[model samples]
Target: MILTLIAYALLAGLALIVYLSWSFSPRLTVGVAGLLSLFLAHGAWKIFRKPTKGRGYRALAAATTAGFTLTAATAVFVLFYGAGCGCM
Candidate 1:
C-alpha cells in the first residue's frame, strides 16, 4: 500500500521531470530516462521473481511492467526519430 503510493509518486515526478526537459536532446532524454529506469526495472524484477508476500506487490509489478513496456516503445520511437531531432 505505502510502497505503491511511493512508487507512483516517484513515477509522476519522473514524468514531470522528463516533460520539463522536453527541449533537451532526444538521446540525452532517452539516456537519462533509461538510466533512471534501471533501478525501477531491477526492483520490479526482484518483486516479480521473488514474492515475499509484500503488500501491493501485484500492483507494483504491473506498474513496473507497464513502465518498462512504455519505455521500450519510447526507445524505438527515439531510434527512428532521434537523428532527425539532432541526436548524435
Candidate 2:
C-alpha cells in the first residue's frame, strides 16, 4: 500500500489543481485538463489486460479505448454540474 496511497494522493492533488485552475482560468484550465485526461486514459489503456496482438493493433486498440473512456468521462462530468463545478 504505499504505492496505492501515493497514487490516491497524486490523483487527489491533480483533481484539486484542475478544480482551482478551472475556477480561476477556464481556457488554460480546460487545455491542461484535457491533456491530463488524455494522458491518464492512455496510460490506463496501456496497462489494461487483453489478448496478445501485434504492436500496431494493440496501440490502436488502446488509443481507441482511451478516447472512448475520456469522452464518456467528460460527458458525465459536464452533465452532472456543468464543467465549472469540478465534482469529480
Candidate 3:
C-alpha cells in the first residue's frame, strides 16, 4: 500500500517535471503521462497480486490502479480528440 502511494507520487513528480521541462503541447505531455500511468497501473496490479503476508495492501493497490487507469483513459482522449480540436 505504501509502495503504491509512493509510486504514484513519483509518477506525479515525473509528470510535473516533464510538463515543466518539455514542450507544453498536449501530444508530448499527455502521451508521456498516459504511458507512464498505464505502466504504473500494471505495476500496481502486480504488487497487489504478489504473495505477501499482509492482505491490507490490496485496498490501496486497487484504488490506485483504478485512479491511474482513469487518468490514462482521459489522457488518451485528450491526445486523440482534445488536442486535435480546431479551436486553436
What TM-score does model 3 achieve against the real structure?
0.36
Find the 10 residues in a row with the least total lDDT in model 1: 79-88
Q: Report how far residue 48 has shifted in candidate 1, in Å.
A: 9.8
- How well is each residue in 23-79 modelled by candidate 2, as lDDT tens digits? 899999878868867776765665575746555555655676777677667556444
- TM-score leaderboard ranking: 1, 2, 3
Question: All candidates' lDDT scores?
Answer: 0.63, 0.64, 0.63
Give per-residue CA lDDT, model 1, range 38-88, as digits (tens): 857865575467556656646656776777667666556545544343424
If scored against the real structure, what TM-score would every candidate get? 0.40, 0.37, 0.36
lDDT of 3 at 28: 84
Clashing pairs in 3: none
What C-alpha lDDT, on a 0 to 100 scale, does residue 24 get in candidate 2? 96
Backbone clash tally (model 2): 0
Report the C-alpha displacement of residue 4, candidate 2, in angstroms.
15
lDDT of 2: 0.64
RMSD of each: 12.4, 9.4, 12.0
Candidate 3 local lDDT, 43-68, one digit each (tens): 56754675678566666567677776
